[model samples]
Target: MKLTEVQEILAKSSQEDWIVDDESGSFTYKNDLNLHIDRADFDSYREFNEPWATSHPDPHAVSVEYVVKYGSSFVDKHTLVSVDGHRATLPMPKSINDLRVTESDVNFAKIVNIGDRVDEYLKRARLVEVEDNE
Candidate 1:
């Protein structure tokens, strides 16, 4: 698969939908998978305090948002629901690089393996097992 296709699939597909073909060495997105990462174990995430502040594309933008906007070309939409139903302002691609998509340009599905990466981080940090939500 080409770089663009990998990106497109990732933009719309969830972690559960990643499809890897063994023979052809191609990846695709499908909804049949019954696996997923329930939550991420991270030090912190970035968020914007001043939406109007023009200091280089809102430096306070949520760390994830900053990374997606500047780091990769994921233009699709994703949402999060609040437990308290509070209103907030957040957008994709807060910067040029994010935790998931690190490199400026690469085959997303091929390069990103959230589960393994997260596990490694948690293990190295001596964090306990994060129950897989599968």
Candidate 2:
């Protein structure tokens, strides 16, 4: 999605909700406070699930929670983890929706307690943008 479109969506959505309009995929949040991306897409609504859960029928992987820490220009401050098990702190993605590595300043790291379970969250916990240089 273009920046104009994302701005439009954000403008239309409520403050309690953050519409993650991007090129890769889109998901909306009730607010930035909670880490869980509630499955409330109007057409369908359900509980948030882990990206790897397959016992029932949901495309979500694991319930990953993230903590965004603010730091200086060259440091990362995002920590991601499962609501239940496993944890991985990732560097922010440079752009939202689209998973493109466009900047050399924003670095991303992946640490997993489990195999590929943490990968899901790490992928989703992308680098939104680089803070403007003041």
Candidate 3:
């Protein structure tokens, strides 16, 4: 997927619950839930079997909330685990220079709004192009 694709998809959706945080260079969308993506870093990696429920009745059944796999110097994959144990893995860009947004990434991230409204918001925030037609 590409950034233009993301913009196009967002533009066509009906939901308007989206946010772009300039301070952190992150975007968030809310439906019944929230999905967030950080533009700056991907350092929040965790082991699948970490003891998240150390004090729970089923300590050994600790849920693996999320994981980040790396290759060489860049992130290779990002996985999200739901409370019910379902998992979804998304391939990441090889480097910052190759960073681009995809539909799956947006869907998995639960991004809601996009298009002209979002562009207008980004414009007001000065985070994207300021031209009227952009």
Ranked by TM-score, top first: 1, 3, 2
Model 3 TM-score, all chains together: 0.23
User: In candidate 2, residue 48 scores what lDDT?
Assistant: 43
* Whole-model lDDT, model 1: 0.29
RMSD of each: 15.5, 14.4, 15.7
Q: Can you write out model 3's per-residue Cα lDDT over 1-134, one digit (the tens) per residue?
A: 34454444443434355465535534444431234444423343343442221222333321222211122122223343211122222222223243333444434333322222333322222222222232
TM-score of each prediction:
0.25, 0.21, 0.23
lDDT of 2 by residue, 1-134 (tens): 33343333332443235444323223333443222222222333223443223222224323333222212111122322222222432332333344433222222222212233334543444434333341
Candidate-wise lDDT, in order:
0.29, 0.31, 0.32
Error of 3 at 80 (Å): 22
Off by over 4 Å in 3: 1-16, 41-134
TM-score winner among the candidates?
Answer: 1
Residue ranges of candidate 1 with Cα displaced over 4 Å: 12-40, 52-61, 65-90, 93-134
Mark the regions of model 2 whose C-alpha exceeds 4 Å error after superposition. Answer: 1-58, 61-63, 66-76, 79-92, 101-109, 116-134
Q: In every candidate, how many clashes are there?
A: 18, 14, 3
